[model samples]
Target: MTDTHPELDDLVLPFSVEPLEARGRITRLGPLVDRILERHAYPPQVARLVGEMVVLAVLLGTSLKFEGRFQLQTRTDGAVDMLVVDFEAPDRVRAYARFDAERLGELAADASPAALLGRGHLALTIDQGSDMSRYQGIVALEGQSIEDAAHQYFLQSEQIPTRIRIAVGETLAGARHTWRAGGVMVQFLPSSPERQRQADLPPGDAPEGATAHVVDEDDAWVEARSLVETVEDHELLDPTLTSETLLYRLFHERGVRVFEAQTVIERCRCSRERIVGMLRQFSPEERRSMVGDDGRIGITCEFCSTHYQVEPAEVGVED
Candidate 1:
């Protein structure tokens, strides 16, 4: 019933690996996440923060296996009130970020992650088809920066060792004209080769079928970590720096192997079916409470800020 996403053709970031048993990847998210976040008319700084989150979602999502999608969300009582970025493939990647406008202004002047998010929780939820149950990992937002928080999430939840560097700001149009939101993520593959030597197992004990899988994962991760380390934050946030350019800047001397790039898009998951399903959850009394004398209920999607107005007729059991 759904048509192919048109924006899939637009994602064109480059991925590569190096001689030091490592690899590097970079994504230029302008054609994807930025489109959705900017549609909300976000201020420059706010857009940048959201943009970083969106790109981060894509980076993490690409590294995951999912029949559905990955949802990364952060809720804080800081300048950034709520942020959600969804990475869906077969081309349905999208994201949205919201913050208190007044607080964002202060953040623009000078704000710390603590000042922005307060003591909040960052959650990563994975949603696949009904055949699959959703899994979520929650961690406290105690780090000085978002990157640190993400690194913590990978270590504590997914148990992946990762390194992330993110920078958000206006896109560079000219020397002074700005028109972008920037972000970058560098991650180490999960489960080190050394860790596979679990203590419980016999000395030099290798499972019948698990040795190669573990070794491959460890090799890939080690190489990825090394290649990614050569990158600098300046190279990452430079709007002029294409994905290939950024990698080249990092490892021009080493031959970097590449994988096909998956496209990311600004697709919202809203639908009449989804909306109706949620509306059906409200008991008659709760419906009455939300609806005013005008006999209408107004609901808005906090992610995309899309407003929906439901008349009384739209509710209740239909004949």
Candidate 2:
């Protein structure tokens, strides 16, 4: 059941279960998650949350039809204030987190997402291109985990019945520690125009003594959700289980079919040229305010922590 392709460390598989009338996405991030996390020396709890965000971003971003970028961001009042992850089209992703070191240290290792993020809104942004309008969806962070928040997002925003299961942790390989994350998302798709029309129709419109058409689809949805709920975290994070094998194990009885998988890698879009272009837009006063005692302007990318320094002369400014 393993795919013939070699690099399965960071890949996503799009799948469908015909009998269940559902479509889903599965993602595994091994080396990619490790590479992204190694750039920053975050605490274990913080790192775990960040890893979950990375996996969640891939699962949600791959579901979109946009051509540019998909970003998942959270701003809260808890120990961890902000978590941001960006997924660019094809297969590139980068993530970063901001937290109060002292506060984070005080929390237990098994703190829930709600305990870590507190009161905040989870926002998803889709940037199609410079020419196309951007789209965003915001939802309250009411769940104990990122998966719960995401499920709520789909339920409220797209009116889609979705189930998400994610697991992130580190595994010891010999003497070295590696980060790994895997997630599965299943969404019930409307099967026909009649179903869609029934869903859109007011409840009162149902014929006398006739059951609502959606009740039938609701039963299917409930069954699919029940199956998804049976997925264990270990099954998702097990390195030995191929994506196909895992899907088969879960939905073999339901006739699951998978499409070609997409490979993902850790990538940051930050560059000196882009940074310089951005700085050039600032007025002379604004630019001067950014210069440090070293007589140069330095900017660091929050995602990759790559530092960029620009001399005043480079932007036609005299110190």
Candidate 3:
């Protein structure tokens, strides 16, 4: 029996996710990458991986039900390094994945996560709401790809079967430094034999009811795994090719439903007021030293690289 619930459609670029099937959705994750790329000029490898994290943050954060933060963190001491992407209310996101900034352009697609990150662990942190305790799940890295790492997280933490395909690459360059990052994720919902009423499940190359079979008394899991396993590296990484078109082309006959989309925007969330507040923490002498001859202070936001100049006198210092 298929899920008869209202379905979502395939979402477009810049933070959108639409339902492509009753139980699945195809997301075109770009514009979000382009925004991040505008702030950076990393190598092909690093840029792609960073995009993957940004997309993953969206897919993993949709159900952040309460008014708090849902954080995805990966800590490592490897060459490529630690990566963290977090999503807050109203679908706001902030991401940073540190690497060999100096040696970035030298990396290749075949580079292993181990070679990039050295050693690491992936974690998901969620702040449900006020007073409620925060929830976090820790999962070990399994492959050189972020998709593989996330798959492991779903199994270990959420105990659900999931398939994740990610593509990271640049579509434009130089004065046109526009790049795109996109991904698709599908998960199986819990089902019971008593509820088995065929809702016309798609005719996937995977075995019939393979998802249910893999866990229970079904044998179709073998077929389903085979279908998902066929997703190719080239297909996932292609920019001109959108996710909806690809998924529809592959499974249209099986009744894949694509739905409405959303947009992902970029925000630094840094303000002069915030920076000024930080400066106040300094002692009188420290503040005086910072003021210099012109009595102006310079502070730069780490994420967006925006610089701010403030006058000491305007702030009104109190001894």
Q: Among these predicted structures, which one has the highest TM-score?
A: 2
**Deviation in Å, model 2, residue 201 alpha carbon:** 14
Ranking by lDDT: 2, 1, 3
Candidate 2: 10-residue stretch with minimal lDDT: 193-202
TM-score of each: 0.76, 0.90, 0.72
Assess each prediction's global lDDT (C-alpha) against the native. 0.63, 0.85, 0.62
Per-residue lDDT of 173-244 in model 2, one digit per residue for the tens?
A: 659988889999998886764442224445576677885545445666777788888989888777777889
lDDT of 1 by residue, 143-261 (tens): 45677788778766655456666655554443643334445455543234563231232335666665433333455555556656566656655554566656666657766555687
lDDT of 1: 0.63
Which stretches of candidate 3 lie above 4 Å from their native place? 1-22, 102-110, 172-177, 193-225, 233-240, 277-297, 310-319
- Where is model 3 poorest over a 10-residue stretch in terms of lDDT? 13-22
**lDDT (Cα, 0-100) at 165 in candidate 2:** 89
How far off is residue 167 in model 3, in Å? 0.8
**Candidate 3 TM-score, C-alpha based:** 0.72
lDDT of 2: 0.85
* Displacement of the residue 66 alpha carbon in candidate 2, Å: 3.7
